[model samples]
Target chain A: MKDIWKKFDETEPSHSSIHHLMAVYHLHKKNGYARGIDIANYLNITRGSVSITLTKLRDKNYLTEDENKFYHLTEQGQQLVNSALSKRHIVKRFFSEVLQLPAEVAELDACKIEHLLSNETGEKLICFMGYYLSEKPEVLNFRLGFRQFKYQCQSVAECRLCESDCFFSGKEISKTG
Target chain B: MKDIWKKFDETEPSHSSIHHLMAVYHLHKKNGYARGIDIANYLNITRGSVSITLTKLRDKNYLTEDENKFYHLTEQGQQLVNSALSKRHIVKRFFSEVLQLPAEVAELDACKIEHLLSNETGEKLICFMGYYLSEKPEVLNFRLGFRQFKYQCQSVAECRLCESDCFFSGKEISKTG
Candidate 1:
């Protein structure tokens, strides 16, 4: 079957909205209230931009504002945050466990992919991964070779470790030196 | 624990680049090759924009192009795609299983979350979810109840026919409704 990612590619979302939602979710989780300045500092963005987004989120009932410059997730807002958190976990696993990407790249890619999948397919993937991890631990090990490669002294050793049981056996690992 | 989403409230990725990547990924998956026009049609974007993005991806070694208007993922490009796909699965599961979001919202949120989490956190989450799903299925069910409520559902029964125990009581079901 065609991967679900291919199907949902047509309806990609705005990255700003996703970013705003994540910021709100994290802030609320850290402390019951989050300020625009704190969010800006954490994300390395301008306070002006954060203020604008906070205002928008408040207007949308995703946030409640207080006199102390703090914002909290409303019930509606909490629901959105919860969903966002779930997506964050899934994306992270896919990168680190399934495709065996480097930590930095996997983390970034997970953030992007979390916004692109459909509910049905996403659930199936989770189920599949769960089953695969339980039933086929070797797959997980093979997929996670990318992360392991970084700690290895030689790239070929990393490739050999992976190739011993990897599905993509024919592909040769070219030496860097 | 501090949720991770709070770290990106004002940050936004380069929209054109992300959109272009999505378009190319979609087209390549569909036809095993993609041209500017194919990407344009799939993404509802201009052919000129597709051409520009394709040139950029080619230069970056994410794509290989030829006279037949076809392009394929280079080794580097394949790595990126594989990584993205893995992360997508992780994000999807977190929303659907851990957060117990409805299929629709979980999928949508997963798409957004996939791009935001750090690899360390993502891996930790995977380990947590894996253990949580297997060891304490009941607590997870209760969490699912919360998710159902968040989506405005009256109760878990409203979403599905209970065959096992009720989430609230952990008692076996007697009827369909």
Candidate 2:
């Protein structure tokens, strides 16, 4: 584990690099092209700072500039973004489906977690979610159910019809049981 | 999501700091006290390098030195280590109990994951595991069952009597189904 962290520290790009990659992704998604200024503006940093980072990224072969002077992610960059996004999806599913967090909260948490979770744990999460959902598809439904239940119920005791049906009820019982 | 990553970058300590905290933790656990040489030997780094990082940790107030020159983690340091270790526990449980990975692999993965997982995702994983386990205690049983079954069965097709009773059989069918 110590060696793994050290290797990650040595090889993995900094948070700013990830931020740049994501900024490029979001900028491209928004405007169909990512410009250096667009990345800077999106990140709330200076254009010169973005340019420096972009230059480093290009030197590292993670980005390229076209004839139109628009920034684009290379295959390596795309893979890095895709891998991070994949981890986010697994974590978001765990949050929304398994823990029944709100969609927005799940999305936000996933973004934070994607960078932090190891590849092994990320793959395990994907497998576990697949296995758990196969066994209990209702867990996937818990997101919508939780929202509706939260809106309807003033308190747990008030939901008389939801005694056995409510997802959170089981959790409450488990705490005491 | 972007803001969260930026915030973590600004506030979170470097990887070396985390490594030092972990070294101190392990040394204290193994020897009842941590010293500079112990940290250096444990990390396979020079005592000078250890001193530099430890000085930074001390400046950051993560460690304290006693009159006997033994090192100890401060409350804040203990909290940080505990939090990271807690994340490891959740990931390890998911790998071993949910995905049925080997114990050593799970441990290694957990150690790697502990550093990567966000607090939000860590908390959610804890809740998800609790909820999932409460709903299906068989997942816990599957851990032990898998070890025994792994020793007995040569391959998936070789398990005759273990068809429906096998833990991973359902997972395999689910994958193809």
Name the top lDDT candidate.
2
lDDT of each: 0.51, 0.64
Question: What lDDT score is found at residue A19 in candidate 1?
Answer: 66
Deviation from native of the Cα of residue B11 in model 2, angstroms: 4.3
Worst 10-residue lDDT window, candidate 1 chain B: B168-177
TM-score of each: 0.46, 0.69
Per the 3 Å backbone cut-off, how many clashing residue pairs does candidate 2 have? 1
Q: Per-residue lDDT tens digits of candidate 2, residues B90-114? A: 6777777666666766776566546
Model 1 over residues A61-100: C-alpha lDDT tens digits? 7778888877777776665544544544655665566545
The DockQ assigned to candidate 2 is: 0.11
